[model samples]
Target: MKTKNRILQTALELFNEKGINEVTLRGIALNVGMSQGNLNYHFRTKSEIVSELYYNLVEEMDEAMKKITLDQPVFSLLYESSLVSMNILYKYKFIAQDLHSVLESNSELKVHYLALQKMRKQQFLFLFQNMIAEDLMRKEELKNEYERLYERMNILGDNWINSANLFFQERSSKVAHYHSLLFEVIFPYLTQKGKEQYLKSL
Candidate 1:
């Protein structure tokens, strides 16, 4: 691997092993077997490495989203996407480990994340429209109901990793447990047909 990529990977490993607050650029350089000055050429600060990793995480998630096609049942697509998302998040688990602080300390990343959230909300709205048209979801009957649900989902998505790190003693079950909670957020909005198809797809 190239020096830059190696630094990012090593930084990710260290960040996961030790929380972001504890891991320093010097520590990462040591693990990468490079002098601190050499590492500084690629990333001057720990936050710089973190910012790069955050963008990497977003690119990976965008790739995952691209895998969704119209050929499958919407419910199945959701299930597969949720599972894939969970796996990706787990792979880059440290980003979400100190999510609030990471974003707060970096204005540019916080802005980017907010924009992504807006885009994701539109995507969810589009998906809901499609699901409703296909008899997979009920039309929204309450004011801003789906909107509220999306907010709930956003909260869960943002925090679930940290929550899992704290609550789940075993690493293996963390992704699976949080994944189910995420998918179930939409359950009440599913029509009978949607429920049947969802269960069948599972």
Candidate 2:
């Protein structure tokens, strides 16, 4: 691996083991077996690395979402996307652990996070609309609850890792466990046919 990529990868591991505030650039340098000056050549500050990793996470999620098709069952897409989301969350666990503080530490990252939140809102809205059209969800019921449902999903998606870590020391490591909880939030709202299809998916 190139020096820059190695630094980022090593830094991610350190940050995951320790919160962003607790890990220092020097520690990352030592862990990677790179001199302080050499690490500095790539990332002058830890915040710089954090921002890059955040964007990298966003890029990965976008790539995963791009693979979904309108023809695919919503539950199947949810099943696959949940794994992708969990993998990214694990890769950048520090951010999820202390998302507010990490974003507050950097002005640019805060702005990007706000933009990403908006994008996520739109994406969820589109997903719901598609499911309604496909007869997988009840449009009449969802029309009044879109905002509330999205809020629940956002809470679970964003904080599931932290919650799971607290509740399940061993099971938290499994992506499918987290994904199942996330999928369950929308399950009750599904039509009978939708529920059958979703069950068949498993």
Candidate 3:
């Protein structure tokens, strides 16, 4: 692998194994078997490496999102998307694990992340509209009900790693377990036909 890619991979492993705050650029260099100055030649600081990794994660998710379409049943699309997202998050588990601190300390990343989230929120709204039109999702009983549901999903999606690390004894199933929980947020809002379709999917 190229030196730059190796640095990022090694840094990701170190960050995931040790907390991001706990792993310094020097530590990453040592892990990569390179001199600190050489590592600095590739990345000036830890935050720079982190910014690259963050964008790398976003790029991967964007690529995955491109594969999904509205042609499938609503629940199945959601389940597939959730599983894909969980797998990506698991690969870069440190990001979700240290999200608050990582964003809080990096102003540029925080701005980009907030903007990305806004786009995702809009996408979810569009999905809800489509599902309602198809009679697969019930009309919102209250104003912004599905908006709130999206927020709840956001919370769970971003923080489930912490819960899994603390409560789950079997590491292998953590992604699957949390993927189901995250996808379940919309279950109550599904119409009868939707429920039937979703059951058939299972």
TM-score for each model: 0.94, 0.90, 0.96
Best by TM-score: 3
Instruction: Please give the range of 10 consecutive residues that has the lowest summed lDDT in model 3.
Output: 70-79
Across 1-202, the per-residue lDDT of candidate 2 in tens digits comes to 9999999999888888877878999999999997999999999998899988888888887887787664666787778777777877777878888898987888888898888889888988888888888888887653559878988888888888787777676744556688888878888888888899999888
What TM-score does candidate 2 reach?
0.90
* Local distance difference test, candidate 2: 0.83
Pull out the clashing pairs in model 3. none
Please report, in order, the local distance difference test score of every candidate based on alpha carbons.
Answer: 0.89, 0.83, 0.91
Clashes of each: 0, 0, 0
lDDT ranking, high to low = 3, 1, 2
Best by lDDT: 3
Better structure of 2 and 3 per lDDT? 3
lDDT-better candidate, 1 vs 3: 3
* Candidate 1 regions with alpha-carbon error over 4 angstroms: none
Candidate 1 at 38: error in angstroms? 1.1
